[model samples]
Target: MNAVAHNAQSVINAAGSTLEFLSFTLGKEEYGISIQKVQELRGYDTVTRIANAPEFIKGVVNLRGIIVPIIDMRIKFKLGTPSYDQFTVVVILHLENHVVGMVVDSVSDVITLTPEQIKPPPEMNSALATDYLLGLGTVDERMLILIDIEKLMSGADMGLAERSPA
Candidate 1:
């Protein structure tokens, strides 16, 4: 086989066996979510505060015509003081017929990981509960905490649903 054709075949084979993740950072740690769950990426914008909302619930913003509740993973995980800088981004996710946005320090890139690169998360007490993690993915020298975005968003603590007026 020609060198060029061999390389093309290798690329095609790799793409079919790997899963893609949209990697982002929160504090110094790196995290990733399934790329299929991501609806879009948006710059961090001011959100309207909701009464009686939890601190992690940064509030809601109008995304096109729909309202999206923005959650700060840093606050949700009690990592540290969450800040909004130029690098701050909101990852819009479409889950279970609901749209939500998550704020992260910065979005790095989309990474493809084969099943062999993923490891089951270790059982330990940590800021983030294990239930919210899919597993750990290692790429090169970096480790990505694979977030179960759907479970995290729909959990009771997130309060993603709109509260009806009393």
Candidate 2:
């Protein structure tokens, strides 16, 4: 192949091998989710509480006429008592069949991590189970806990819808 063709192929291969993540902060630690699953990001807002719902479930919100259940990650992960302020954000996720919102402290940025930059998460007793973790992604001096968002949101514990909205 010619030099120019080789360079173009290299670029295409590199892009195909890398994955993009939407990074956000929970407390002092950072976490990431696949960017493809993110529907939108919205500032924290009041949600109508559901009767007899779990505390981790902040309740549901009307998003453009669709009611979306909001789950607070800080509470779910047992990081600490969650405090809401201007910086708090709700990341709307579009899963295979359902749409849900996850509240976080704040969103950092969208980071692209090559396959080589990701490492398997350590197997240790922690608030979050290893099954819910995709791996740990390292970018520069930062280490982000890559979350398996689909698995987490779709689990029976989350009580999310199993079918897409009509």
Candidate 3:
């Protein structure tokens, strides 16, 4: 085969192996949350810090006059202390009955994933608790960590019962 033909074939192979990820940086690690869960992405804006809330609860933002509590994923995962700068962003997520925001370092892009491109997380990868991870996906030669948005947004830690006091 000619050199030009061989180079083109290589490019095709590389493209075929690429997977899509909604990439964002948490601490120093690049993580991927499913694009399906994402409602919108916005630049870092002033947050009305709420009192008596968890430290990770960065507070509420007036998104189009609707209040949304922003959770810092770094703190939620107990990854490390979080520092913010110009690159910080808030990713709004839509759940069953509500919409919440999660803060990440920055958002990269949306990439696609294939079956063979993903693998189950290793045991003891419990930094953020691998139980919440659907799996790990490889896209563009990088690993996109898949997260279960339902599990993260359900407020399972709040221990709020469905029925109120009668």
Model 2, which residues run further than 4 Å from truth?
Answer: 1-16, 125-128, 161-166
Order of all candidates by lDDT, from best down to worst?
Answer: 2, 1, 3
- What is candidate 2's lDDT per residue for 111-136, written digit by digit as tens? 99887787766656556456666677
Give the C-alpha miss distance for residue 123 in model 2, angstroms: 2.3
Which predicted model would earn the best TM-score?
2
Better of 1 and 2 by TM-score: 2
7-78 per-residue lDDT for model 1 (tens digits): 333433555788899999998999999898999999999999999889998899987888788899899988
Per-residue lDDT tens digits for candidate 3, residues 1-166, read 4333343234334646654458898977888776767889888788898788888888888878667878888898788888888899899977655678899988988877765676665556335444456567776668777666656566566322231321
lDDT of each: 0.81, 0.84, 0.71
**lDDT score, residue 76, model 3?**
82
State every prediction's TM-score relative to the real structure.
0.84, 0.86, 0.76
**Model 3, residue 75: displacement in angstroms?**
1.5
Q: Which ranges of candidate 3 are over 4 A from the true structure?
A: 1-20, 125-128, 158-166
Off by over 4 Å in 1: 1-16, 125-128, 161-166
Clashes in model 1: which pairs? none
Pairs in steric clash, model 3: 19-112, 20-111, 20-112, 21-111
